[model samples]
Target chain A: MVLIYIDHSEKEIKKSSHEAISYGAAIAKQLGCSAEALLLGTVNDDLTALGKLGASKVHQLNNESLNNFDAKVHASLIATAATNLNAEVIVFAHNINGKAIAPAVAVKLDAGIVTGACSLPDLQNGFEVTKTVFSGKAFAHIKIETPKKVIAINQNSFGIQNFEASATVVEMTLPIPAASVKVTNVNKIIGEIPLTEANLVVSGGRGLKGPENWGILLDLAKALGAATACSRPVSDSDWRPHHEHVGQTGIQIAPNLYIAIGISGAIQHLAGVNRSKTIVVINKDPEAPFFKAADYGVVGDAFEVVPALTAAISKMKHNE
Target chain B: MNILVCISKTPDTTAKIAFTEGNTKFDENGVQWIINPYDEWYSLVRAIEIKEKDPTTNIHLITVGGPEAEPIIRKALALGGDEAIRVNSNSNDSYVIAQQIAAIAKQGSYDLIMTGKETIDYNSACIGSMLSAILDLPYVSLANHLEVNGNTASVQREIEGGEETNEVILPMIISCQKGMAEQRIPNMRGIMAARTKPLKVVEPLATNAHTSIKEFSLPPSKTGVKLIAPDQMDELVKLLKEEAKVI
Candidate 1:
């Protein structure tokens, strides 16, 4: 059996989990096995609806403590579930949570684990999985020699596909481990589209000049319904919150469209956002390194060009 | 207080990646190795800061690699680590590396264990959490800020949209990221001190790697950029609308 770990936050299922389910389902189909999902905590989404993405069954351990992520506890629970099901392959979305727990689970099960997997395993001769290495600059094909295997798919690498199926949901009663950490306070920005989940992202760098000039970027982001991000230098300069920084040293996002304004595409910065489907760079410097990676490039001043683009988008929306 | 920082040696960011032996092995020729930026900049520096705050604290560096990795470990010591431990094994498998670190950590009874969020080379982001499981300690990954008070540590980590603050007790594991601490440069005086620092090489515990690399290949290079003049803003918008369809 192929088991997929469904990652959820605050009862809402994450977008990456859907992709993982589809990827796991495809793997199961390729291996001639059944695809199942494991949910550790209570989730609001209908488990049956998840079946459309391709799981035959959903095993849920509805424990309140499980809602808060503890790497040790989650690893133990998932390891138990994988063992109980006699899973040949286990899948996880290589998000923050999955990256934390997958290796521990791999250690517990003695499974050959591959994280940041970009493509499905080739089962023709041996189980070879291709994964991103060198911070997205290269790919390495890894082969697992162990009987049990664990694979964590990178976000946005595999698009989600839906099929016609109804998955049976089963509640599981397993021993829960004590959490080693406690939540003192959570300062979460409510109602903003997360960078990881956003299909469109508008990011800026020091080219915006200061925090006061951020209105133009916000206008463009609001008009496009996109999340806002910044370069590492911008965050370091305190022009934007550190959470908004997207680079090798910051949050890595794989949005469908990444619009970068005034940011010189440093190699470290490119390491984070290079996975975006379409890169649009707006910079006054024609020789900016980011232009080399952009799908579409516009050589212009951000102060003038961003406002014009925002106005044009607003007008386009008005016409609609 | 004893603090343990896990260090890794990785190729520099600008190093041209190439494979040898029918693309089955990483070509190490003409490659420059440095302490992984994440390890040196965040994890090791933060541990040093903690030691600075408490004069009684001792910071130790550890790595799982062959003799070539000793220079990287010594560089870490120059940045204020008290001692170094080298587990003599060179394996790309994260599980094996974690087991080795966990075994050493168990013997040391460290109050705090730290590592970078992930190495730039392999980018597994797994060693710290795996060590936590093996040691059965609290684990926090990608911690941006950390504050320790007595037995409890308050850590702020980035989530999707915002940040989550966690308070974990001592004997815990944390994977450091940016904002945890500032990067420190080693001075000549520190370099001299590092040369005298104790770097004990030990044999690794018997642990088998579960995974092996079949081959390596670089991502296809990007095609040359298509530039549109500033006056051709509408043309760019039209292309985005009709050609790319991302908007």
Candidate 2:
């Protein structure tokens, strides 16, 4: 059986996992096998709704203890689940949680692993897989010779292809190990899209001048319904929270579109966001390093250009 | 309380990457190695925080690499660790590296294991989770903030679209990222004291091998930027519609 690991937050399915499930179901179809799903933790949505994504069955370990992600415990339980189902191919969404647990599961199963995979495995040619290397700069084709294989599919690589089918929901009991890591209290800042998963992002830098001017950037981001990010200096200067920083020293992101206003791209900064599919730079400095990497560059004041762009986008959306 | 933080020696972020003669290994010549930045947050800073919370805490830095990795190990020691350990091995496979760490953690019977979410060199955030699996412990990844009280820890991790906070029990592994703690530089006195600290060097135990890298290559450089005239908004729109198709 081919197994897909469904990643969810607050019982709602993640966009990335939809792609993974589609990818897994496609692979299983190609192999002339059945596609199944394994969901860890509690989910609020209907389990059978997963059938729309491609899974024929949903194996749920609904223990509330599994709801909070503990990578070690997750890996152990996943390894056991894979063994129980006699899974030949294991698929995961190449997000933060998948990056942590997939390799560990591969180790437990003694299976060959491929991470950051951007395409379906070429099953006709020795089960070859392609993955992003150099921080999403290039692709490397790898083949796993081990009988059991693990693939962590990159986000946005595969489009979601939903099919109408009724999926049987099976509740299975697996040994839950005692957690070594204790959780005392949770402190979270609510009400902002995470930079990693945002489809559109608007980021700023020192050019914004000070923290007070941050509202302008936030305005543009809000207009586009995009996530807000900052250069390392902005965060270092306390203009933005450290989590909002995106660079080699900060969070590396690969989004559909990344727009920068008033930020000069350093090599470190580029390394983190270079994976973005499309880059748009609006900086007054014509010689800013960021312009060299941008697919579109406007050598004009961000104050002038951003408002115009925002207005144009809003107008286009309204017309649509 | 005894704490063990596993550190990895990695090429500095600024170093130019190159492959060996046969494209088999990452070229290390003339490359500067630093204590992996992620490890610095999850391991060293957290260890110091524990020591500050209780002055009796003993924190040790450990790495699985050759003698050449000592200076980087010493740098981590200077930051806050009480001592250091260098396992004589150089392997890129995550499983092998985790095996060495699990062996050390088991032998030391340490209460806590901390490491970076992923080493920047390979961008593989596997070791901590793999070690956790091997050691039969709970693990947290991408912890942007962490705090401990007694045997419980409250950690916040970056999730898709937002952040999630969890309360976990101790004797677990936590892979840290930014927002966990600010990076700290060793003081002059700490640097001087690090030179005298004890560093134990030992041979790595047998490793369970799994996979290998076939080759390494650089990414294709992005094309030069296309300049769109500020006043020619119509032309820019036409270009985006016809040429880029990103809009």
Candidate 3:
């Protein structure tokens, strides 16, 4: 069976998990097996809706203790569940949680794992999987010889398809191990889009000037319903929170469309976001390295160009 | 309060990455290495925090790499780790690295194993997890907030689209992400102290690697940006509809 991990926070389901279900289901169909879902912790959403994403059965471990992400305990529980269910293939969304948990689970099961998987397995060739390497700089085709396998699919790698019907929600139980590590306290970024799963992102850099001028980036981000990001310098300078930094030293992302404004594309920054499907750069410096890597470039000041772009977008919506 | 902070030496984020002949090896010719950024969060900061709380608490840094990685390891030491250990072996794969770390963690019986959420180079984020699995311990990944009390740990994590808090026991692995602790720079005293700290070198344990790098290559350069005149707002809209297809 193909088992997909449905990642959630609190009771709300993560959007990426839906994509994971779709991908897992398609793969299951290809393998001529049932695609089942394994949801940990307590979730408020209808577990049966996973059927729309191609799950035949949703195995939910709705324990209150499982709600918090304990990677060690989580891996142990998942390993036990996979073994009991006889799951040959396991899948997770290649987001923060998945990135952290998948490797541990792979170790527990002694399964060959592929992270940042961008496509379905090529089962024709010894279960070969294609995954992004070098921060989306390229792809490497990997073949897993192990009987068991784990794959963490990058968000937006597959489109979610809805089908008619409901999938069975089967509650299952696994032995939860006592946690060895204790969490002392937590400090979280107040409000912002989860960079890993954001589809559209508006990123700025040193060129944005002081943090006060950040309004331009935020304005553009709001207009496009996109998340806001910044270069390392912006974050280091405290123009934006460190969480908003997207670069090699910052958060690595693979958004669909990434707009870089007032940023000089250093290779470090590129390493973090080179996987983005489309890149738009706006900088007055014609020699800015980012322009070379952008699908679209505007040789203008972000201060003037961003407002114009936002206005144009709003006006276009009005005309529509 | 003994703490183990795991770190790795990886290619600097700004290095012009290239693959060796036939793509089997990563071209290290001109690549400058740096301490894996994640380790800075979970290892250095957490180590500093623990040190501040209890001056006697020792934070030791460890990595599985070659002699060339020593300088970067020193940089980590400079960051605040009391001492460092360099496992004398090339990090062939995550499993191999995990074995080395597991061996070290076992011998040390560290009260906690902390590292970054994931390394920027391999981008695996697997070591902490694998180590925990090998040790049969609980782990928390992508922890933004962490509270260590005696032997128990409670963490706030950003998973998926929201945040969830988890409480677990100690001697477990925790891979830190953003907000775990503030980034710190080594002061003069810390830098001087780091110079005098012990840096032990040990041979790596035997490992069975399950994966290998077949090749490395850069992504194709994007097409030059297309520009629309400043006043061509309507044209831009038309182009979005007819050309970009995003509208």
Candidate 4:
């Protein structure tokens, strides 16, 4: 069995879980085994429906103590389940939660592990997985030598594919160990879509001038129904909240479309969003290094270009 | 309280990334090295702040690398650590590196163990958790704000969208990130003092890595940017819709 750890928060499943499911299912097909999902925490989503994403079995591990993510607890439970089931492969979404837990789980199971894996393993020859290295600057194909293997798939890399099967929900019971670390408080950002979950992102930077000029960026984001982000300088200067910052030091996002406006393409900044599928850089400076990495470049001031682009998108939406 | 902080030496964030030896190894030529930002700016600084509050608290730094990592380790010591450890062996495998750190960490009776969430180079983000598992310690990762309160600690960790505060008692591991502390530069006095600090180089334990790198490849570069004039908003939108299909 290939056990996929389903990641969730606030009673909702993250899209990354779907990718993990699909990826696990693909790997299971390669290994001629079954794909199973392990979901913990307080998710309200229907567990059985997860089969559509690609799991033959969905294991729901629930306890009052499992309300918040405790890496130790999660790792222990996952390792136990993987062991009990004699799982050939274990999978995680490689999101924040996965990064925190997968390593420990691997160590517990004494399994060879690979994180940030971008593609499915090449099992024909051996258990080899390709993963991002050097902060998205390059890729490395890693061969896991251990019999039991764990892999955390990079988000937005392996896509979702519907598996025409209905998964049976397995009510898993594991005594939740007393957590040494307790979540004292949770302050969640409401209303706005989280940058991590956003498929489309509109980000701004120092070139936008100041906080007063941010209306145009927000307007564009609103028009496109996309999440808004800012550069490290913008967040550091208090022009935007720290959570909106995306860079090497801040939140890293891999949206389907990342529109970077007025942000100089510093390597630190690029490290965060370089994994984005299609990057659109709008800047007045033709020499800005960002243009070299951008798929679409607009040599114009964001002040004028953004509002106009927003209006065009809004108009196009209205026409549609 | 003794705190063990794990530090890593990585290429400067702004350095151009390239491969040498036929894409099998990182090209270190002309690359500037720095103490990974998360370790220097957050993990070590937060440790320093804790030690400042309780002067009795001791901070020990550890790095797993060859002699190339010594300068970076010294830079970390200059921040405020009392002593340091340099693992003699260096490998591309993170498991080997984490294993070496764990070996030294096991020898010390520490109330706290901290490390950067991930190195910018590999972005493995696993050392703290790996260490926690190897030592069977509780861990809270990506802590943006950490405060020591007696033997227990309060840490504000960055979650997916927001932040959550986690409380842990003594003898826990944590991975630090930005927003944990203000970055501090080593003053001339501290730099001079770092030279005299005790830096014990220990031989690596016999450990086998579970994974090995097969090969490396760079992402295909952008074919070329389709530059559009500022006034061509409609055309740009059309391209995004019809050509890119991302809008």
Candidate 5:
């Protein structure tokens, strides 16, 4: 069995899990095995729908301590569940939660692990997976030698495929350990399309001059129904929240379309957004390095160009 | 307080990515190596911050690499650390590196273990959590704000769209990121002091790497940018839809 770890956010299954389930299902099909899912914490999502996504069975482990994110507790339970199900391969969504626990679970199970895998295993000679290395500058094809393996699938790398099947839900009762990490407080951005999962994003930087001038960027994001992001300097100056910062050290987003306004395309900043399908750079400086990586470049003042683009997009949507 | 901070040497941010030897190995020629920024700017700085508050705190640095990594570890010592240790082997596999560091931490019996969220080169973002698990310690990932109160640590970590606070007892591990601490440069005195700091080199434990890189390739470079005038917004939209098909 291929055990896919289903990650849940706010009692809802994360959208990225759909890609993981589909990827795991593909691998299971190659191995002539069943693809099953294992979810921790109480979830509000309909487990039956997961069958359509790929999993044949959804194993749910409900525990209060599991509700909060604890890498130690989660990794141990996942190892146990994988053992209980006699899983040959374990799959995860290479998001924040998946990256945190997958390696630990691998250690527990003595399984070889690969994080940020963009492809399924190629069993031609050995079980090999390709992953992005050096941020996105290069790719490395790695082969796992261990019998039991763990692979974390990148969110946008795999497309989700639906099948005509209903998954059986299984209630798992494991010896849940007490979590040592105490929850002190909870602070989350409410009701905003998260940049990690956003299909489109409009980002700004210090080139915006000041925080007050951010209305132009926000208006464009709203027009496209896209998530808003910023460069490190803007967030460091407290002009934007830290969570909005997208760079090598900040949030790593791979939105389908990314629009950068007034942000210099520094190597560090590019490391995070280089995975985007299409990059549109709006900067007055033609010499900016970001232009070289951009698919489309507008060498004009963002203040003049962004508003016009937003209006055009709004108008186009209205007409459609 | 005894704090063990794990660091790695990586190519400078602007280093050109290339491969040699039939695309099996990274070409290190002319590539400037520096201590990973997240390790130097965040994890090590935060450890120094804790030491400055209570002068008795001991900050020890460790790295899993060959002698080539000594300079990077020494540079980290200049920033702030009591001593350093270098595992006398070079391996890029995350598990092997974690096992080597875990051995040191077990003997050191440190109260707090720190590491950057991920190295800029490989970006595995798994070593800290892996080490924590191997040592049976509580772990927190991507901690931005941390405060130590005796035996307990209050940490605020970055999630997908927000942050959350968690408290853990001593002998725990946490990975640091942007908001954790400000970057610091070593002054003349610190540089001179680092020259004489004790840096012990130990042989790596017998460990097998379960994974090996088969090949390396670079991502396709973007072609000529389609430059459009600012006033020609309509044309750009048409290009985005009809040519790029992003819209």
Candidate 6:
């Protein structure tokens, strides 16, 4: 059996979990086995609807403590579920939570593990999986020799697919491990589109000149219903919060469309956003390194180009 | 208080990645190695900051690699680590490396252990958590801020859409990122002192790796960019709407 950890937030299941479920289902089909899902905490989303993502059953451990993620506790619970089910392969979405717990669970199960896996395993001769390495600059094919295997699928790498099936939901009562880490507070940025789940992202750099000039970027983001991000130096300079920083040293996102304005596209910054499906760069310098990586380029001053783009997008929306 | 900081040597960020031996091995011929930026800037520097705050604290650096990694360890010592430990092995498997670190950590009984969030080369982000599991201690990943008082530690890490502040007792493992501490450069005096620092080499515990690399490949090169005139805003909008369909 293939077991997938269904990642969720406080209110609902995460968008990346659907992709994990689909990936697991495809692996199950290849192995001629069943695909199941393990959900922790109490989620408001309908568990049965997850079947469309390809899981045949949903194993839920509804505990209040499980809501606030603790890596040790989560690893123990998932390891227990995997052992009980005698699963051959386990899957997780390579998100913040998955990155924290997957390795520990892999240690517990003594399973060969691969994180940041970008493609499915080739089982024709041996079980080999391809994963991104060197911070997304290259790929490496890894062969797993262990009988049990664990994989963390990269976000946005596997597209989610829906199938016609009804999954049976089962409630599990297990001994909850004591959490050594205690949550003192949770400060959240609500209302805006989250960078992790946003399909389109508009990011800026020092080229915006100062924080006061951020209104145009916000206007573009609002008009497109996209998230806002900035380069590392912008965050370091306090022009934006650290959470809005996206680069090798900051949050890594894989949105469908990434629009970079005034950023020079340093290699460090590219390491974080290079996974975006399409890149559009707007900068005054024609020789900016980012242009080399962009799918679409516009050589112009941000002061003039941004307002025009925003107005054009807003007008297009009105026409729609 | 005794703290253990794990570090790794990796190809420089600008190094050209290549393969050898029918694409089955990493080409190390012309690659320049350095202490991974995550390890140097966040993990080790944070440990140094804690030691500087408390005169009673001692910082020890540890890495698992062959002789080629000693220079990297010396660079870390110059940044303010008091001592170094090199586990004699050249394994790329994270599990094996964790087991070795766990053994050393168990013997030392250090108050805290730390490492970078992930190495740039492999980008596993697994060693710290795996060590925590083996040592049966609390673990935290992507710690942006950390404060230690007596036997307790307060850490703040990034979540999906927010920040989660956590408090854990001593004998914990943390993987650090940008906000943990600022990067430090070694001065001439510090660089001279690092030469005399004691670096102990130890044998690794018996272990086996469950995964092996089959080959290395590069991502397909990007197609050259299509430039549009600045005044061609309508044309850009039309392409996005009709061609790319992202909007």
**DockQ of all candidates, in order?**
0.74, 0.45, 0.42, 0.84, 0.78, 0.80
After superposition, the stretches of candidate 3 with alpha carbons farther than 4 Å from their true spots are A163-166, A175-192, B144-149, B152-156, B159-168, B178-197, B238-242
Off by over 4 Å in 1: none
True-contact fraction in model 3 equals 0.45
Deviating ranges (above 4 Å) for candidate 2: A62-65, A122-128, A137-145, A162-168, A175-190, B233-247
* Number of the predicted model whose DockQ against the real structure is largest: 4
How well does each candidate superpose onto the true structure, as a TM-score?
0.97, 0.92, 0.90, 0.98, 0.97, 0.98
Candidate achieving higher TM-score, 1 or 2: 1
Q: Could you tell me which 10 consecutive residues in candidate 1 chain B have the lowest summed lDDT?
A: B230-239
Please, what are the lDDT tens digits per residue for candidate 1 over residues B92-135? 98888999999899889798999999999999998987887788
lDDT of 2 by residue, B125-180 (tens): 77887877688777778877777778777777777655677777777788888877
Better of 5 and 6 by lDDT: 6
Residue B6 of model 4, lDDT score: 90
Model 3 per-residue lDDT at A108: 75
Worst 10 residues of 6 chain B by lDDT: B237-246
The TM-score of candidate 6 is: 0.98
Task: Note each model's CA RMSD in angstroms.
Answer: 1.6, 2.6, 3.0, 1.2, 1.4, 1.2
Clashing pairs in 1: none
- lDDT of model 6 at position A73: 89
Instruction: Give the chain A TM-score for each candidate.
Output: 0.97, 0.94, 0.95, 0.97, 0.96, 0.97
Cα lDDT tens digits, model 6, A1-320, are 99999988886899999999999999999999999999989899989998999999999998877988888889999999999999999999999889999999999999999999999999976799999998898899999889999999999999898899878999998999998899999988989787988899999999999999999999999999999999999999999988899988788889989999999999999999999988999999999999999989999999999999999999999999
Among these predicted structures, which one has the highest lDDT? 6
TM-score of chain A of 1: 0.97
Model 2 DockQ class: acceptable
What digit string (tens of lDDT, one per residue) describes model 5 on residues B163-201? 889999988999999889998889888888999999999
Candidate 4 regions exceeding 4 Å error are: none
lDDT tens per residue, model 4, B1-247: 9999999999999888888888888889999999999998999999999989889999999998899899998899888889999988877677788889888988999999999989988888888988888988889998898888888889899887788999998789999988898899899999999999999998889998989988889999989888988888999889889998887
Put down candidate 2 lDDT per residue, A55-112, tens digits, no spaces.
Answer: 9999999888777666777888899999999999999998988987998899888887
Q: For model 5, how does the per-residue alpha-carbon lDDT over A68-166 read when each residue is reduced to its tens digit?
A: 888899999999999989999999999988988999999999999999898889999799999988888889999999999999988788878989998
lDDT of each: 0.90, 0.81, 0.79, 0.90, 0.91, 0.92
